[model samples]
Target: MTARTLPGMTTISYPPKPSPGDRIAVISAGAGLPGLLPRPFELGLERLRKEYDLVPVEYPATRKMGSTPQERAADIHAAFADPDIKAVIASIGGDDQITVLPFLDRELIRANPKPFFGMSDNTNLLAFLRNTGIVGYHGATVMCELGRPGAMHPQTADSLRAALFTSGAYELKPAERWNDINRDWADPATFEAEPETRPAAGWTWVNADRVVEGRSWGGCLEILGWLLMADREIPRDLAEFDGGVLLLETSEEMPSANEVFWTLRNMGERALLQRFSALLMGRAKTWSFERPNGPEEAARYAADQREAVLRAMRMYAPTTPIVFDVDFGHTDPQLVIPYGGLVRVDGPDRRITVTY
Candidate 1:
């Protein structure tokens, strides 16, 4: 579908580059796990300073684990209002960023529009920024991407570097090797090197006969469900998403396949499922703090999640193209996606390219 076909889904744009000396604010809009575990947080900060050549700044609530929603909102406003800060990154995703949404000052954020990066629970802020006509990022939380054990995932590093410093179309490739297994960060040894990853199962595509391109919308499925239930930033008119691409991923919470189906079924009822021409499903994250699945169990979990997605698409968007096992969301080596940015899904070529 051409861009003209989609109304209310404008292709948002931003400055092409952030200079080396630029200052980027790091805030914990949701969880301040940086307070509890400094391993990844410190490492992430170092990368921002040493590798990216950008100074990393933190807000008052950034490292406070139990900070209130109002405090988090205050930090967000402070980060955006500061003209010296070129971009904002979340320290990590938390469970209640939605609660902080009501306290956000839309006018302030709009006045000082800058790049904001995050994912998972950060979906709340991403949706908020989208409504404000600002294109926010959907991946690269400091604790997850920057503080990744050992070294940054190469694909993730390259994707983020391009997103932060360049303005153009960047192609996304499935990870050659991916890890769904969890490593305990509490153990000091986990920080010495990267976690183990198995061979990639590659991307699974459906209805691969045509090309579809549009502005991307959607985030962690569970977070999207919350937004739906709360009737938050999602456009009231389902047609607003027509011709757009719907990108979704599940978090570490490991919601069951039944849960995934039920969430999509509700979206179908809202008449929101068919608005998109294609769906990009990030690989399911099967391992978490509560349950660490073995390789066999992890494979089953990913398969079940895919089956659930197929079931939903069959009922709601039967002809839409689908590419599964994308490297985004709660998995290791997450790729940054631009919320409301241009994304092209080339089914025939078996490729996906995102313009950030």
Candidate 2:
């Protein structure tokens, strides 16, 4: 999100960018899957060094599964405190990152702000950083985007590169093709080729008559629900999000349409849903290991999720502009969204641009 100039409010600033030769911390803010599955993590590290020309540094808890909150917090502290560490990227996302929130020293992180990159359950840390007045990236993790089977999706790589090394308005485009089906990471053959993909359906827009520009705020819907439940990170005064853009996406766990509706309905009940100038809903990830539906089933799932979101917004923020199936979730060619960054939604032109 862009820096808010409102009186008596803290300005959320973009952290300094990292140079190609800079040292970037590869920490596990969530699960230390790197420890369990080394190939993809190693591949990702090689890319950081060879392709991106950045040095990857790992901390103690970065590879220790079941790491305690205090341990993970310590790694976070060390990464930011070290002047040599120019940026921090999560290894992957996991379920229990919220437990680590209490152990974080917000002031320490704020004092040494670094661009933190991650999504999924790492939404906990992203929201934490925003409250601390540092803009965290809402996409790109070591194992997911960085360690994709074959090569990075050119779009994902370009978006991430811009986010890492530049500061300017970057236009977000719809992917020509996208994939949600995943192969077992444990299988050695999975890395042999890129996953199959389907032709992308362009984003669907609602209220396409206006242009809305504002600082952005929001993350994975499930994690957001958890934050609301724990009552953490969110401002005591909900007005902080007034006129901001809201970015939301679901994860591979694939919550039902009812679950999505109820969570957003609860936000509406809190008087929080109507605050945004626009909503960017990431494409629903319909296929999962547990529920690998074919084309027909997947289509139905996506349609249901979209309807649920529309139903909630119709009740709470009927006039708000919403664009659904924006390809930036647990799908291939995931675009990087700046968490707490400036976004310009030109609905009349059907274009989206975010400040990197």
Task: Pick the TM-score winner.
Answer: 2
Q: Candidate 1 at 297: error in angstroms?
A: 1.5
Q: How do the residues 123-211 of candidate 2 rate in per-residue lDDT, one tens digit apiece?
A: 98988888888998989899888899999999999999999999999999999899999988889999999989899988999987899
Q: For candidate 2, which ten residues in a row score worst on lDDT?
A: 1-10
Task: Tell me which residue pairs clash in candidate 2.
Answer: 1-340, 1-341
CA shift of 352, model 2, Å: 0.2
Q: What is the lDDT of residue 46 in candidate 1?
A: 97
lDDT string for model 1 (115-146, tens) is 99999999999888877778888899888889
Instruction: Give the number of the best model, judged by lDDT.
Output: 2
TM-score of every prediction relative to native: 0.96, 0.97
lDDT of 2: 0.91
How far residue 121's Cα lies from its native spot in candidate 1, in Å, is 0.3
